[model samples]
Each structure stands twice: as C-alpha cells, then as structure tokens.
Target chain A: MPLPKDETLIFFSKPDNALVKAICGRLIPGSPEDPGAVEAGAHQYIDHALAGYYHSQRTAYRRGLTAINAYSQSQYQKEFVELSNDQQDSVLTDMQKGTATGFESPKAPDFFNTLFQHVREGTFCDPAYHGNQNLVGWKMIGFDGAQVAHFDSHMQVGADQSERTPILTLADMEELNFPAPENGY
Target chain B: MSLPKVDVVIVGCGAAGGVMAKELSTNGMKVVALDRGDFLRTRDVAQLDELRWQTRGELQEPMIKDTQVRWRPDEKTDTIGLPFLMASGIGGSTRHYTTQHWRMLPHHFKQYSENVARYGASAIPVGTGLVDWPMTYEDLAPFYDKVDEEIGISGKAGNINGTIQAGGNPFEGPRSKEYPMPPLLQSTVSRLAKPVLESLGYNPFPGPSSIATENYKGRPACTYCSFCTSYYCFIGSKGSTNVTVLPVGISSGNLEIRPNVRVIKINKDSGGGETTGVSYIDATGKEQEQPASLVILSSYTYENIRLLLYSDINKNGMVGKYFMDHHYPFVWGYFDDTVTNPSTGPWAANVAIDNFNGDNFDHTGLGFIEGGVLEALGGDLQAIAGAGVGSWAVPMPDDTPSFGEGYKQALKKYFRRIASFISQVPSLPYDANYCDLDPVVKDQIGMPVLRITYNAYENEIKACAFMQNKAENILKEMGVAKMKKAGLFTPPTTTHEVGGVRMGTDPTKSVLNKYLQSWELPNLFVVGGAVFPTYFGYNPTHTIEALAYWSADYIKTQCKPGGSLTQYF
Candidate 1:
C-alpha cells in the first residue's frame, strides 16, 4: 500500500522532516526482503499525531531537532539528513546514551526516547490512525490482527498454530462476519 | 438549577457507587449518582485499535484536559505533573481492568495483630501506620460471595469450610462454598508451567477472574480475544460495572445516574457536623445543586481524598493519609522449543501461585515484612505498548539491539516464543506516602488538583527484589532457553491504589467508623478502596466490591429513616 498524500505536516519543519526521515530509515530500515517504519508510514503517523493527541511535545521536538542539526554540523560539517547512514547511527547511539552535546531544554536522551516510542507506535499500531500502512508491521511480527480469536484446539501446550489463521483488520471484520455487540456504543 | 432531594446522593458512579446504587435502589430508596465522564456505549469501543485504547489514554481521563495530578518523592521536593492510572467515565477504571478478581486473605484484615503474633513486636515497621481493618474477612466473606456470584466470577475454590481442595490456592481464606462457575480455560503458558510449579511444591490454579467462562446473567462468555485489559470487552464478557451492576442499578428505576456532571463540593450543615447535599457542574456547563438526606463518597482513592480535602470535611486532617499501591515487578522468559502463543487467551495472569502471598509463607528471617503472588500471564503482548523499555510483554533480551535489522529479526523470533510472569508486591502505609490537594494547581473545573507524596518504602523495595528472584527461579524451572529479569523500580503508575480515607474502630486515627460511615458525620459514608487500611498482594477489586456491599447493607439496615445512628456510633 502507498502512503497517504492528504496528510499535512503540522510539527516538523523542512529540516526536521528530512531529519525524521533519516531517523526512521535507521531505526526501522527496510531491505529488499523486509518492510520498515518508512514503509509503514511512520513519518505520516508522527505528523498527524502532532496536530492532535501528541500536541504537547511540539516544542520539545522543535528544540531537539535544532540540537541534533547543531551536533551534526560540529561533528560532520553537514546537516543531520546529509550524513551517511553509519554517521547517523553513531549520532543516535550518542543521544541514546545521553552523551550527545548541544542539547538544552529537552534533554537528548528524552528526545530520543520520545521519538523512538512514536516510531514504534507508528509501525505497529492499527492502520486506522494512518500508521502500520497495510499492516506491514503486523505481517513482519506474525501478528494476526484483531480477529475474534477463539482457540480451543490450539490452546494446548506446545501447539504451533500460527500458520492456521489469516490476518484480519478492522475494515475486514464486516466482510468476515465478525459478531458486533447488540447495543452499539 | 436545583434538583429535588433524594434519599442518597453518591459521587462517582464507578465500582463502589455502582454497587451502592443497585443495593439501595433495589431496596426502594432513591439514589442520584453523578459521574464526571460520559456513559459510554458499546459502539464507542467497537474497533480494537491498539493505539487508541492501549497506547493512548482513550479509556482513561486526559491529564491535560480534565485533572492535573502532581507527584513528589517526599515533602521537601518540588512536585511535577504525573499521569495517574484512573478513568473518569460511569464505569471508571473497571471498564479497562484485566478482571483479576481477588479476595484479601484473612491475615490482610488483621495484619497488625497477625504480624505481632507471628514475628513479635519489632516486626512492625516503625513509621508504617499498619493497623487492623475494622472488619474481618469472616465478616466480609458473605459479601465476597455475593459479588462473585452477582458479577459472574469464575475460579476453583481453594478451601471450602476448612477442607483443602486440589488444583486451587491452598493459602486462600476458607469460603462457604465453591465458585459460581468453573474456571476459564488455561492458557498455553499456564498449562506448560503447571507441572513445573507443582514439582517445585507450589500450588498453581487458574486465577479468579470476573470475566465470564460461560454465558450467565444475559452476557456472553469470554471470547479470549487477547484485548482484555486497557480495552473494553467487545463481547461484553469482562464483568465491568457498565456491563454488570450499573445496568441492574439503572433498571431499578429508583437509581438515577447523571453522567458528565462533575461534583465540585459537598455542602455541609450550618454546624458543619453533617452533609446536606453536593454542588456540581453539569454537561451543559451550568452549576447545579443536588440535595439528599445522605451522601456517599465512592470515587477512586485519589479523588475521594481530594474531594474530602477540597470540601474541608476532613475534621482531623486524616482523610488523605496512608495512601498505598501494589509495587509490581515483571519477569519474562523466551523458549525456543515451546510455542508460548501469548495472544490466544485472556490478557490477565491466567494462573497464579499464592503460596508466597500475604502471610502464607514464613517471613521470619527474609528481611522483608511481606511477599507477593507470582503468576504466569497471557494475551497482553500487544504490538504498540509492548515495544518500550521495561514493558512486561516485550521479548527483547538485554543485549539485543533496540532497532534496525537485528531488532527486526529478534521481534519475529520472540513474538510468539515469550511468556511473562508478574509479582504484585504489597505496599504498606507510611506517613510519607500520602495524597493531598495541590496548593497551586487546579483542574479544568477550577478545583484544587490532587497531589501525591510517595516513594517505595524499604519493605516494598525488598519485597519486589525477593519476588523478582522467585520469578526468575520459576522461569528457570520451566526450562526457558533465555531469561530476562526486568529490574525493580518505583514508577508513579499503579492501577491498584488504595487507602486514603481509611476505616478504623477508633475515630482518632481514621476518618470512617467500622461501618464506613463518617465518625463525625454519621449520615456520610465513604466506600471503595479508599477505606482500606493497607495494601495487600492481591488485586483489590473483589474486596472493594464486597466492602461497598457491606456498607450498603449497613446503610439499609441501620441507617433508615426512623433508625438511630447510635447503633453504628
């Protein structure tokens, strides 16, 4: 599935956008055989969340992105997005260990923690939120998404029933004839 | 606008209020219950969206938009805004709870005396205000049976009238009879670990759950959909107040639930000895007064304390004292040979070993005053919430890379190969651990927000370490290929918070009397986990429900129109 084009950037600036894309590339990098956070529309998920549920972190992201660029310029004489993948990984490792310099209000480790959590959520959360596009993350992790799972025979110890069931999503529940509650909320 | 006076006006239609409404209204007394959030419908949670329900605060109250809770380790430190584990709707936190219903063991009620008898006087920690509950487990056993049957709990009774039974918690307090229904089907993790636990000389049984095993009381049985905790039961099998007692209360005709109405203050009589009514802001943004002959405070622990402190009804300043929570420690194991399909059963701990809980095991030389129950849980391995640091269901070992190719490979390999164990360590009440009204911050309704002053005591920290070691041993005995011990730390989050407005036989140290009625204000009653004297290793929902019923029975029998408060006093 393709990424949604209707999403407008709410929090990330031009430089921050490039930085986020680079970060997603290393955090959940895709190869010819596997899908990653970029393929799951993680950037779009963060972009849409900033306008609503995660609006409180807007200032922190702004400050953290600025510090990352400053650290990148000092170390590599280039912007964060302009660095090689190995260099970007090194910078992220420093931030993760809380040893990165040029961070002020929102600490470097705190920013990394928040960004990493959001990336995970974007990759694995249901597709209703515009993330997990086409359920790539679920497929990668072998999660049969949101089925009315009643496993009487497969619940025995040492049973490997993973291959028996097909993955289902919220959109497919109706066609699959999953039972809905009598009184709707 | 002013509402007509009723027999009783209850605040916060959650666990306690739901029970009180049903009991009082069924007994033909008029009741008006107020809740701050909307009475959510079944369709409001039709989709099992992990991001909205589990990862985000969909079922919980929004800290920024509704109330602000500040927390500080001690009195000398500055407080920061913290998110409390509570919900605001009509059914409250029970709507999203994992439904691990537990009755407090007999010793939990008389801990002060039992500890002294078992370990002598010095065993009682110095500053910990450990006291015996006003009522004993025997006195509340009938009520426990009532709630278990009424709410459709499923479990195997360990002991029935002094006879020990097999395949059950042998340490449990003796019940008058067996459970209303058989236990839920055991998960693969529990089934695999049963023989191992038995070989280690521990009793393992299916944990008591409020989730239905078979269709009873017009609700469907559990579907084992793996979306049990932190999400509404789409099948209406989990026994939340919304699906169980609240509907009965509403059908009684005498009970009126006013949703989206925030009670700001409780109005007192001119002499300040009794409550007359309560003032609230309705959903239309208008101030409304609801007058009643009796008032019951049945909100969550933090709010119950906040409401009492906000209204200045805590005559001796003891309302917000002695706050406690169960300090939780989790351990996970990865098995290469066993396919622990964790996503195919109820999300709660499916089986539990209670041999170490409460005072069942000898704590004579353990250096810790208490121990916790260890259990093998299932179906909580959600995609989004499990991808964080120290998450219980995350299968990544300590040495694994957090992200990239290695992380991807690890996720796929361990996703279905992991099983988790948790220990609910009991937290004792200390003078330093308490709740109070924030002096500076206010909620959206302009009322002073609740502030918590707490840190894990020596007993709790020691207990957590002890339980973690035990958990690791059990996982090793189960022959897991790789084991990971999630180290113990005191986080500000707890779903099982108890004891703010405590009950005691003596009025000097407690806010409520033996019957959960106010010591000073005889007509006022405070129900819920707020009346607990100390935290127990077990989940407090069953005890909370039982206490609510016990208090309602007292109100019904002793505090009638022509009855006198002398018997209670």
Candidate 2:
C-alpha cells in the first residue's frame, strides 16, 4: 500500500491522474463563482483514499478508468481529458446508462456509480479528510459542518450567522474551544 | 473442562440478555452471562465521523463466516449473504441504535383474532403464518410501563388508563403513566407537520425515545446531536444497556458478565430433552464448560435461532422457521424557503403519525392487511449524505443527472430544503421464508452458517406500496415544490429483525412456550424478537426487555425451590 504525501500521486499514475481530475471536474463542475468537487480537491481525496481505506478498489479503478479513456478514443478520436465539455458529458451519459461498449468486470454503469459516489464524498466529507478544501464545498452549498450540539437556539436561525455560528468542523473543535465530549473524542 | 455449578447461565449479553443479567442477579440468583464481544462504552468508541461510523461501519459487527447468513430473494434464486448489521458488544446494537422506544398496539398482540373478527377469515392471506400472541397487550402493559420508568423514555402520554391524553400517541394502548421525562425539543420538520396533519385529521406527536430530555437516572440529557444512529453517545444520555442496567447488575455482585467468550453449544442431558449447561470458547481461545440449573438464550434474533439449530435443539423442526423483517419505503421533497437544517438534532426526532400503522386503519378493500409508521424524516438527513447521489436509498429525481452543474445544484437544493418521509412496514412470515444451516458455507471455526430464504409476501408488498402512497400524500399536503418517490422494496437498514423461534400455544407449531421457555426442555428459556408470534411495525427493543422482565419474574417465583418449571405444560 502506497501512502500519499503532499501533492504526491500514490495510487494513480500520471495518465490516470489526468483522467481522474477530468472525470471529477465533470462530476460536479463549477465556476470560480461557485466552486465544486474539482475546486474541493476531490481527486486528491480519491488518491488519498485509494492509498488507504479504499485499497481494494485499486484494480477496479485501473480497469474502469482505462476502459473509459479507451472508449473515449474509440468515439471522439481523443483522450477523455481532451474532449469538449458537451462531448465529455455525452460520453459520460452513455457510461451511466450502461450503453457504452468495451467494458467488462465492472459494467459501465457500475463504474460510473462508484466514481460518482467517491466524487461526492470528496466534495462533502470533512476538511480533515483532504476534501472540502478551504471549506469551499460547505460554503458553496450553505451546509453546517460537523456540529455536535444543536440546541433550540441552533435550530432557530436568522440570516447567515457565519460570524456567531459559522460552519464548524472536527478540526476546528480544538482551537475554537468547543466543549470536548466527556468520553474524550 | 467443566466449571462449578451456577443457578443460571445466559448467552450473548445484548438487549435481551443485558436485561436478564440485571433482573435475575438483583433477585439474588447467581448468574454467569457470556458474550462473544466486548463490553464497549461511549468512552471506548466515541466519534462524530460519518465515514468511520455510518459508512465504514466502525461499531457494527464484522462479517465472520461462522455468523454470516446466506440470503436469497426466494428458493428459486442462488444465495448471496452479508452479515446482517448488528452490534456484538454487551449493549448490542442498542449502544448505537437511534433509541426509538415504542410499545406494541393492542391489535398487534392479537392480530390473527383481530383480523378475523374485523374482516372475516377470508381476509387472511394464504400461506401466511400469522397468529395471536399467547400473551396479550394487557400482559405486557405493566412491563412496558416498567421500561418507560426504569429505562428512561421521554414522551407525552396519549392515553392513561381509559382516558385519552393529549400530545401522546392516541393509538397507543392504555398506559399507567406519562413518560419518565418530557419529550425532546421539536425540529423544524416536527413544527411544520403539526397543523397540516391536524387539519387533515391526523394526530402528530413527537416520537417516543429512550434519550433523556432531563437528567434522569444519573445520565445527562441528550445534546440534540444528529449523530445518534450509528455513533455512540458521547455523554451517556441515551439509555443503552451498558449505561443503564448492566452497571446496576454489576453493583449487586451477583452477576458475572464474561466478554469475548463465545458460547458455541448449549450442552444437553442424556435424554436430549433438557439443557445442562453451555460450552464456550473463552477470550484466550480455550474451550470450557460451566454447569447451571437453568439456561437462557438471549442473543440477537439471528444468533438465538442459529444457536438452537447448531445445538440440535430443534426437536420438532420449529427452530428457525417463520423468519421476518421490516421493508422500509421512503418519499421526500424539496422546499423553496424553509431551512430545516436536518443535519441537527436526534436521528428519530420530530413528528410522526401512527394513523396508518398496524391495524389502526380499516383494511377494508385497501388491498393490504396492515401498514407502517409514517414520519417526517427531516431530522435524520445528514448534509454529507444529501450530497451523495443515492444516500439513504433516495436517489435524485427521475431524469435528473447525478453529475455536473445540475448535480451540484441538486445537492444544494436537497441539503437545507428537503423534508423526507418513510414508513417502517413489516413483512409477515410465510412457510417458504425460513432459515436453516447452510450446506456450503462454513465459519472459520468449521461451523456451518445460517442460510435465510426470504421473500416479501403479497400482503407485505401491498403494505409497502400503501405506506409509500400515504407518505407521498403527507408530503404533498406539506406543499413541496419538487417531490421524489423512491422505489418500493428498498431493503431495511434499520434492522428490526424479529421472528424465527416463535412462541405459540401449540407445542408442534412453536419453539418456546408463552413464558419464552423451550417446550422439550423446561429449564431452557429463549427470549428476544426470535420468539415474536408476529411482526408489528415498531422497534422491538422495549418489547424484548419487557419479555425478559416477565420471564425472569416467573423463574424467580414459580421455577424456584417449591415450584415446578413445567407447571404451564
């Protein structure tokens, strides 16, 4: 098992890295106005997870990602990352619908689902886990992140109370002086 | 090697077994309880990480081949097995459970008789194994009250005695008193659903839970943390058995709960009619035996049934038949304005209506015999989970892509605005759906695992659709912009597993007697959801505890020195 260092590709090769970045960008694409999975470093999460918890899916990633690029070349005469946005989306639709050919082991739809689930996890998971970079994902979607206690006051919210009750995280609990659990989490 | 004799030996210290350990030992009976897992506390495994707890299953049981069950949709299909989600430690799944405390409706206890009297015998579905419980709601009523006060439940009283009480479940059977503590604070969904339901002539109230609203019985009050379902209580507010009964049992000095001791077999006498003691593999992996006058099997439903068959105690082949579980149906919608931050508060918090549950409604011409509890599922939705394409069995709406800018917009809409709903509809037992020893699969210990063959009966399928329709109606009434209806027959992750070794009046048809005692062996008692005569659309923990108290009372008085164990027989 390879461990990921900062900016290091532990599981993905240089070619597969570009493929992952391209796929994740399309999975939850956004502009600078509203950053999404790509801006949240979801591909980095996938790289980190594949090195550790999701090590079993390494072969599946290799096969499915390779199959996807191969299918892209067969259709558009270019690699997956080089396709136009419209063309890329069309290819992804065929993959999701399981209509795309040159896929085995994990069918096209299965691979799409797995990749989509991971991309979502990368965008929405806690900042400590490498995704949700700079808390941009939570900010974009207006989510309350990892709050332990939601008293009556917490429920009754006015306009964005980011100053008083900003979106908190597990990492913020210590420095922000949130009450530690009696069980010492 | 055989150890010294004890008065009783109980196996698998879980929801039912923990109660036995508390009740019998307090009554001066020397008891030894063996558990295959550790006695974990909140301090041992407290975290708020969804990836660790809910996704990766940090607190759930590992799928050991020995305890795994082979599952098939029906007998015609090949089996695919996953270890059912259950906790192994002393508190069992209760440690991480959402703590929805409930009592069975009066009709639920006598379903067969009630159905026949109300709709005639022809209304009964074919090949169904429905029966009236040997005991009535009246029999279990006092014990349910015991669970409320002793175990620390929080809710209003819908009805006290014959008088109807406000703010509680009016459909609940007559209770002796109100809940031990007041109900938890309402979520936005609970507040929103109240008047809409009342205007539509439905009673909406806070769901009864075992979490403390006030500082009851020395535990702190609940913190309204949304991480209640899969995560352990960081502060011991929730009434898990580890924090409640087992500690009290330990203080008495009459009970010994040995963890990491796997009870493999219930040793039988020469006649094979009575149990002598149990053989267990201790923590060091050394096999040992302990002699006892009485034996109680109080594990989870699966293990209680599996151990009986493994021990060859199925004298009449009634050991692992009539397997049953719940089939959950979900419906949800998105709001334009209301910010019901669903990622806060308790998992089962907020408003629920039991109007469609059990036989509460007239089944006449409805094409279904029973229904389920429909609730405002707003509070339990996690923000991170809402971002996923298909978390909580709810995928994006029809024709909506699960990716790109559209998917990103969908997540933002689903997060703060969605008010979800679901029903815990129960499946009935058919002769064809049952569990037996697997032919090909064996555990690491070379023990054949249990194989479960189950399929929803026509009645249950109809019930699932009925509940889904009801949920959709409630959502539509609440005035939602975009609605989504999940597919029917989504397998239940909230495993309210019940039935297998059923209790009945007839010895040939049941494994245990009315008191949950084995028919052939008077000294052997089996308890838990495994002995449920029929399934009800409610959580089974309170019922399991009530039965333990009832049987322990019998063992104390009637099965003691001057009394005969087989008096009922």
Candidate 3:
C-alpha cells in the first residue's frame, strides 16, 4: 500500500504532455467521442512503466523520446506540448509518414515506430506494473484483474454472459493513499 | 593441474546425464558428471511466485546466453545458424518444461521409406534430411517402459497388450506396461468441450502429463497451483529428473556430480585422434581436467552436437546436421455463452484428440505423412497470460471508449469468457535445415556453440495450416460463439531441438550407430534428443529418457565388467 517512486512520475511540460495526450487519444481515446488519453490515465500509467518494468524497452524508449523532441523543434520551432492540437496532429502524421525532421536518421524511423507502439502498449497493458492507472484500460477492454479461471459457464455457447465480475482492482484496496520511501535503495 | 582419471565422464546432469550417472556408477565404474548450472534443491524450488519467473522467462533459454539458430545459404561465411537456444541450469530444460512425454509414433522410425513408397519421393519436402531410424520402435519399447516405470508416468493406458482402445492414442507404439499413476483431474473447461468433441467424432483421452495425480512411489500429489511449464513444482509433484532420477542416482555414491563446471573440450590425444578426457572451466573460471576411459555426450540436443563439433571428433565430420523442431500454432475462441471457470488447475487441461497424430489417419492420399495432436491446455494465469485486456464484457461493434462507464461495464462482462484450442504438429529434418559449427561467435571458453540453420519446407507449412483448420473446425463443432485462429506463425527454436548427430546404420550416413555409439569412436556414446531421427506430436522428455535408458543399458553390457577398451576399438 505504498506510492510509486517520484522518478516514475511522467508530468511533462504542457507542450510535451499535450503531444502524449494527443497520441494516446488516437490509440485508445477514452469514450471514443471525447478521444482523450487523460480520461484513460494513459500518460501517468506510461510514465510509471517507463520508470520501471520496461527494462527491455530502454533503447526504443530513448529513441522515441528523442524523435518526438526533434519533430517539435523542426515543425513548430518549439516544444511538442506547446504546440496547438492541430499542429501536434500534423507532426505525428508526418512522423508516421517517414517525413518528420529527424526521420532521415538511420534509426529515426525505427525509433518513431517503436515509441508510438510502446506508448500504446503502456496505456493498455495490465495495471500490475502501474500502467492503465485506476483500471481505465482494463475497464475499456473488459479485462478482470488476474482472475484464476474463467472457463466456467461463461465459456459455454449461448450461455448468459451477464453477471460477470472482475477479480479485483487497486481501488478495492482499503489502504489506498500509502506513502512511499524517499529512496528504496 | 592435477588430472583425475575415471571410467566415464558424463557431460550433463539432466535427464540423460542423470541416467548415465546412475547406470555407470551402479555398475562399479567411477563416473565424473559435470554440469554448467548450479544444483537447485527442493528449497530453491519451494519458494514459488507467479511474478518472478513465469512472466519474465527466468526459466527459458535466454536470447543473450543461448542464441536461437538462424537459416542462411552460405555455410562457411554465414554465422546465422550457430548457437542453438537451450536451458543451461541444473536439470537443464527438464527443469522448466511442461513434461508431456510421448514416444515418436511407430511409423516415425520408417517415415522416410514408407512415405517414399506411398506418397512418392516428390511428395517429401526437398532438402529435408529425413532418414529411417537405425532402430525400430519395437527395439525402444522395453526401454520406454523402463523409463516410464522409473519416472512414474501418470497416463491412462491407450493400448494395453496391443489392443486398441476408444479413448487412448491408437497410433502409439506398443507399450509393455501402463502409466504408474492416474491422469490429473480434468478442468471445467475440458468437461464442457468433451461432449461437443465426441459429437463431432474425435477421440479425446487424458493427456500424458508428468505431473503426479496421486502419491506415486515416493512423490506427493500435485497441488494444482497453475504455475507450471516455466515454474518448477515445489511439492515434488512434477516428475522432473531432479525429483525422479538424480536423487536416487546421488544416493548411490558412485555418481559424483560436479555442478557449475562448463565442459570446453573433449580432450583428445595430442595427435587429436581418440578422446582421452574432458577439460572444463569451473565456476571460478579455473581450468580442471578430468580423464576418463569413456565419455558420454548427454547434454541437450544442440549442446551435445556442439561439444562434439568443438572437439572435432566425428570421423565423417558430420558433427552437426539434421536439426528439427515442432511447429505449434494455437487456435483460440471467445464464447459469448458462459460455461466453466477459465482458470482452475495445472498447465494443461482435458485430453488430446490424436486422430491426426502420426499415421493414425490415412496418409496414402495426403501430401504429408504425419499430422498433429489437436487439443486445449488449461490457461495458467501467471503474468505472461494476462496479455492486455481491460474490458470484462464483449465490446459492441460501435463502442469506441476505453475508459468511462461503458468501458467499466464491458470489462466486467467478458474477462473469463475466452478459451484456446491448440495444435501440436510434427517437424521433420531437412538437409539445408541442419546444425553446424560457426567459425565466429565463440562462447566464453573459446569453443564454438552449435549453430542451427532451419527453415520449414512447404510440406511443414501445409501440415501446420491444415492442422490449424482442423483445430478451428473442432472449436466450431464445440459451439463456440466466436473463434479465431492464432496466426503470424513464426519459425520454432528452443530446448526440444533434435537430430544433428542422428542415429542410422551406415557410418557414412550418420554419426551414431544403432546402439547410440559413435560409429567412428565406439567407446564414446551420445544420449539425449540428438539421437531422434524425427519429432513426435508430443514433448521430447519421455523419448529422451527412454533413449538414455537404452544407451545406459547398452553401455552397461558392452563397457562394464571391463576386460579392456581394445574390444570396442
């Protein structure tokens, strides 16, 4: 019942945070109509994953962050979060089309593709590693928390699919606002 | 450095190594068994967690230490196929495997010749290095029974005394004995699908699992924690060599096991002719020399061949050739109607329908001789199994929200409404798809690891796609609301790597003879999966154990009560 590390926090400047919000909005966009990543808590969840549990993705993560920074610098002549929503959308589209400023670099295209994919994965993966904050992603995808088996009457054909319940969520824990150690080390 | 001389030097302590250690030691021969990994006791395994190992692949062969084999055209220049992936710790891959054992079907021995006669040689995939096994299924039957009895297999008899049964595999080779224990309990998932399977006319029998259902011999019954395959059983319920063989082997003082010793060379005479001993780098990187009258390469499939090729021993220079691995493509279904608990027990649930396994069905007209076993395994909920789901209910086609009121309701409705049906197809060896030495990329000790070069031929692809379709039909017949075939099938590579130093009658054609002895070097024997000429529909643990017993029995008769090494030469 303890809080995560401060380094794990992904509170970007308005410009950069706005860019992330825009990208995540396209990936899963909460409520389909509003299409916002904040509602999914995807940015916060991604920050947590970046700080921990995504060790295998370090190279891709670094490259991706660099690519986004370069795109904002070239296209808007400013940071990504500072750009307007339309401007952010244009930069992302250009990057995906392999025409962004640094996309010509040997590893730039790869870096951009990997970054967007990781962001999407982070937003949607299980909440065990701190992504999908507040069960937003799970609730969106209809996933229950680490259930043992669901092969019961739920697995039958034409059986009533209602009355199903998730195993548990972090919200269910009584000790929610737990304190964190200054340094686990 | 001081040199110690023993009668035999066994290269590993897993399934084959354990058996060789017991056989030679019990026969009054001094045996020195060396393992590259540490000795993990019950205490090491007793602390089980779903997070630390299962989801993280702590038990699997790593891409860093154990590289997967690659396929390339140029043999000398291309470094792609070298360094096949395999487990390195004590008990080797057996420590982490699911332990579903089955002998290669009877026709597997004569597959090449039989297929040629029926389907014609053109039907066989070109470049495939398929060959008749040097020995017949009948020859390995007694040994298989011995291994089954020793390991305490928990399977219901499929064919007792050569009589075909309705539920068991009708295509399995004759067995001298029955399984030591009864099969594990069937899950609710299996029960719900069984009736539909029968109505569709498929033979579903209890899958042969190594997990103990009841107290067998000295081992306890399975606790059904659902953390298997990648996790070791803490209760000694899983029939790994650590629990079944190594214990008894160690009790007899003749078996001297040295863990953390990485064998670097099969030390030959200065002339580089006959093997005299083995030189290994210990855990501290200190070199130690152990001399022996005989050496047994009982390592994993690729490791055994790698060690031999590094030593430059095979007279014909056919050290690494004919590597094979199975093609597994899963078929999954999401049921709109609920029936059973999705997660309940051990790794595999229910039984297998072996109608298409081996030559069970008509192969005379089919393009491929063997097919696969279509079945479902109870899903293990360890971290790897979660695989990113947020909603609990089926998403409406128009639904686009991931988080909000609609999303929460959806997440609550469909979390456990999924089931998977799978296919286990047979893989054959090919000429281009073989194991060989890589000139570059040496291991820590400067010895080249065995490189695997493999590509599934058209026949294999066809067989896999066919089996996948069959699996889909079975799922549909089971009345699943929505079923999807698991696709984007990548090539396979891992612990079950087989063939390379295949067994055959002619020394010019194979490395090992019928008795599992190197035709060129009679005193040196090779055990483990490398001797298998073809892959079966099931896991390789049981067959490897059977071969180990067969090799051990042969070694005891030919090399024991020793008069002289001159007779072998």
Docking class of 3: incorrect
Model 1 lDDT at residue B177 = 90
DockQ of each: 0.52, 0.39, 0.11
Query: Best TM-score goes to which candidate?
Result: 1
For B1-569, candidate 2 gives per-residue lDDT tens digits of 69998888999777788888889899887889888777776655545666666655565654342377678877888988664678777877778788888898998988888999999998888888889999999999988888887778998889899788888888999998888899888777767777888988999988989888988877778877677776677677787887888888887899998987888899998988778999998889899998888899998777788789999999889988888888877787777766767776886677889999988998999877877778787555554666753224345555466678887777666567767787888887778878888889888788788788888867888888888777777778887777877666644234687789999899999998899989978899998988997888887888988998888888878755668753421
| Model 1 chain A: lowest-lDDT 10 consecutive positions | A176-185
| Candidates' C-alpha lDDT | 0.81, 0.79, 0.64
Residues B297-344, candidate 3: write the lDDT tens digits: 888776788778877787786677777777777766655656434435
TM-score of each: 0.94, 0.93, 0.81
* Per-residue alpha-carbon lDDT of candidate 1 for residues B1-569, written as tens digits (9 for 90 to 100): 67888888999887888888889888888889998877886555666667777777577754336777898889999999876667888888788888888888998888889998999989988899998888888999999999998877899999999999988789889999999878888888888888888889888988999888877787777777777777777767777787788887777899888998888888888998888889998889899998888899998887888888988888787988998887778888888767787767776647899888989899988877867788997675667755552233365877679777788777777777787788888778898889998999987768889889988877888888888888888889988888787656555577788888989988889999878999878888999988998878888899999999998899888766567643322
Off by more than 4 A, model 1: A1-18, A56-59, A161-164, A176-185, B389-395, B565-569
Which of 1 and 3 is the better model by lDDT? 1
Predicted structure with the largest lDDT when compared to the true one:
1
Ordering by DockQ: 1, 2, 3
Write model 3 residue lDDT over A10-84, tens digit each, in one string. 534334445566566654445544333455566665565555665666556555666777778887788766677
Which ten residues in a row are the worst by lDDT in model 3 chain B? Answer: B389-398
Better of 1 and 3 by DockQ: 1
